[model samples]
Target: MSNSVNLDDIIISKRALHLSENSSLDEMADALQVQQRGVWPLYDDNAKGLEQVQVKTFHYAQCNVKVQFNPARIKSSAAKVDNKSIKERKCFLCTDALPPKQKGIPFNDEYLVLVNPYPIFPRHLTIPRLEHAPQFIEPYFRDMLELSRALKSYTVFYNGPKCGASAPDHMHFQAGNKGFLPVETEYSKLKATTDRKLFSNEHLEIFAVSNYLRKFIAIESDEMTLLQTAFEWLYELLEQRGQEPEPMLNILSGYENGKWRVLVFPRDKHRPDQYFAEGDENILLSPASVDFGGVCITPQEKDFKMIKAADLIDIFAQVSVTDSYFDELCAAYAKRVVE
Candidate 1:
């Protein structure tokens, strides 16, 4: 059986790029500056059967084989911005004072699912916080515990307010279905490499996958102390690294192989939404779900846009451009502290 086999017994693989040999990446990115709307279905000609793919900015949907673009669906993620839009940056994630909102899954005290009108995905969801506080995943630790416990089947992730959050005001989280990621499986099967430091005992269990680009973790165990200890080790490392110096960070976490996994994304500077290349006022262009998932989408239909998925993978591996600003800080601190 071919690896491309799906439920329908169709085997598919990488087909081809959307642009021609003459098309340059700069041209594609320049085109995105003017307009941001583009997507193309992919097919594997050598597959056993015909498998058509529905490519989104963040994901590829196919019955037979999964597919994604190399760079990005669009050239630039910059978006138009205005004070009016900025002023409206209320932390809607934890707006319990509001009413119960629903997108796909039902709402609970811990977390609620709401449709993000200005979404990268066609039906993107915003997991809001009930406390209505500044955006931070640790504050609502129980929420993550409950949300993950309830939505055991889903993939939950947290992008630190200063890292990749579009709204850094209110604290909230995100959850989506499984199988949307490429490395989710590969990460699961990954054995411990020499770079990792395992922390496990009767009470505390923590394992950190210390490679570049992707972060594999084993966060959950039968014991709660293990989780707490793991979190502490992670936080201590964060403290040593001085990640607090940064304004934000991007993070991706999910469950597979019967354990939890986490990847710490980084950033270089605190840039506003304009960095994304949105005409008016929107700053984006870094590691994100669509980018990591090898798919991406743009809601705006002003011009033809296309996402390069392979670009995302490579970009993520460049932690300084993506991972939280902890590695350099911590590594330096360790050197200073020891020296």
Candidate 2:
């Protein structure tokens, strides 16, 4: 739309920039020449479809997170997996969150607080289901216990799978460092939601508008039971809502001051790294929220300059529950349909 874009438009916009994996700020400055796009986009050819980033800082950006695949690759990966292991397999999480210490008091009909084994952040924990089922806003209980700590002053986080998860399986949630993304942005914005009467959890926030493009944030509760019950209804609805589910989902939660926040992202975005996939010449397609927002920091300049911002967006958005991934996901559900 704006001429602010360059000839390569997708790959390298006029403001386009790249930061190789594990790179420092100085290294980034040396490569950009102008030394600062302030906020630039990111991508991975290793990725299969539309996915890019928009970030405010480069020097401090970890750059450790990189996509390893796109939907095509995801489909391929899913296809290659041995489905024969279907029935006898145990949920990895149930196995790992083992030797259960004292379980916290159950919060709602479907939700409960439990310890997370492979934590992404400190006190990494989960607000999962008591029945062990899958749901999209899963791992996310509208706003569960892992809240108070994900605030900017506390920690940062990255959700995967359903909302950006590497482990699309296992019913759980995670909270981590404030380095990349603080957990409070969603919390402070809760009061701004449209239906103020909806939440009773007292901690859930609600947005008056869809805050981020394709992204909506809110926390609501009419009462603890209302919050819990509404979610129970949501759980029943999710059987038809969150595709096949891989039979599970995870949420990246954050917050502070008694309130909780969450980002219900989709995971199918992670692709294996090129080195991890095939050879040194291979590329990885790891897409993050920053990339979809417009600025992505890739380890290679080519990824930043190769795909168009719009192109990446189109692909990433498809993973939304309302999109085609639903068709593929639902088909999987149909197969597992219980008689």
Best by TM-score: 1
Tens-digit lDDT track of model 2 for 1-339: 124322122222222334555543223222332222122221112211223322233221212222221232342233211234433455443323333222232333443433333222223234444444443444454345333332233332334443444334444444333443432333344344434222232344333222232333233443444444433443454455444543222333444444444333433334333314444444334444433322333444344345344433444454334444444533342333221
Which stretch of 10 consecutive residues in model 2 shows the poorest summed lDDT? 39-48
List, in order, the clash count of every candidate structure.
53, 72
Whole-model lDDT per candidate: 0.41, 0.35
* Candidate 1 C-alpha lDDT tens digits along 93-148: 43322322211223453444543333333223457654445666554554555455
Cα error, candidate 2, residue 144 (Å): 5.6
TM-score of each: 0.55, 0.42
